[model samples]
Target: MTLTERLNQDMKTAMKEKDKLTLSVLRMVRSALKNKEIELKRPLDEEEALGVVSKELKQRKDSLHEFEQAGREDLAQKTRDEIAVLKQYLPEQLTEEELRQIVRETVAETGASSKADMGKVMKAIMPKVKGRADGKRVNRMVQEELQ
Candidate 1:
């Protein structure tokens, strides 16, 4: 099934199982998807849906970190639960070695000899690594490789 369909199915399952956390997360996903559709004036393909999921997951992670640092463990835990539910829709993440390999290839392809060419390398690599690797981790790897 497509990611959207799968999400809808899981939403129903969550409702049936009385999984409030999962249900809330799924509702958030549905709202994001619907909002995107309304904004773009079209439906999303699987990749587009996955992109939405990735964006939501990233937001949750950032919020979770802030909440933890602010000593709001309860809110942080809720964000963690949301992240767990959202992650089910993403493909398996790239390993560090795999991401490093892609970064090396992208650097070479873009002729990125120095830090100044970071943007070129990143533009080339983002499409290949989208939804698979974390941007911060990829940026650090590229910096380490270039320097």
Candidate 2:
């Protein structure tokens, strides 16, 4: 199923199951998807929709870190729950070794021999990894591989 259909299906299930957390997250994501469609004035293809989901997940992770840093356990837990719900929509994440291997290949492909060429490596690699890997983790891997 397309991401939108999957979201709608799960949202209904959440309502029936009385899963407030999952329901709330799905509603938020659905709204975001709608806004994106309106903004673009066209329906999103699967890749674009996945980008929206990944953006939402990234935002939740950032909020989660802030909540933890501020000692707001309640908010942190809620964000963690939201993250779990969002993760259901993302592609499976890359393993550390797999990510490292990909980073090495990207660096080689781009001929990024030093930190100065980091941008080249990242530019070439980000699209390859997309939702499968976190940007921070990719950056670290690229940095490690370049050294």
Candidate 3:
């Protein structure tokens, strides 16, 4: 089943079991997917749906950081839980070694000798690592390799 279908099933289960947090998160995800579909005027493929989920996950992480920085432990914990829930839908995260290897290969493929070639390297690598690796992390590794 697609991620959206699976999420709908799980949402039903959450409703039956009275899982408030999971239910709420699932509802939010559904709304985000619906919004994206409306914006694009078409149903999302698996990759596009994954992009929506990844965007939600990024927002939760940002909120967690802001909450902790403001000393709001209660809100921080809630954001952490939301992140954990959303993470179930993302592809397995790329390990540092895997990311580095991909970066090296991309740099070689693009003939990226210095920071000037960062854009080329990034363009080559993003499709390979999308949803699996963080873009900022990939950029950092690319810069390090170039330097």
Question: lDDT of each model, Cα atoms only?
Answer: 0.92, 0.94, 0.94
**Residue 121 of model 3, lDDT score:** 90
Q: Which parts of model 3 are misplaced by more than 4 Å?
A: none
Backbone clashes in candidate 1 total: 0
Q: Could you say which candidate leads in lDDT?
A: 2
Model 2: lDDT equals: 0.94
Q: When superposed on Cα atoms, how far off is each prediction in RMSD? A: 0.7, 0.9, 0.8
Give a tens-digit lDDT track for model 2, residues 83-133.
998999999999999999999888888888999999999999999999999
Global fold similarity of model 1 (TM-score):
0.98
**Steric collisions counted per model:** 0, 0, 0
Which whole-number lDDT from 0 to 100 does residue 17 have in model 1? 99
lDDT per residue for candidate 3 within 54-124, as digits (tens), equals 89998998899999999999999999999999999899999999999999999999988989999999999
Q: Please say which candidate is ahead in TM-score: 1 or 2.
A: 1
**Largest TM-score belongs to which candidate?**
1
TM-score of each: 0.98, 0.97, 0.97
Q: Against the true structure, candidate 3 has what lDDT?
A: 0.94
Indicate the TM-score of model 2: 0.97
Output the lDDT of residue 18, model 2. Answer: 100
> Model 3, residue 81: displacement in angstroms?
0.2
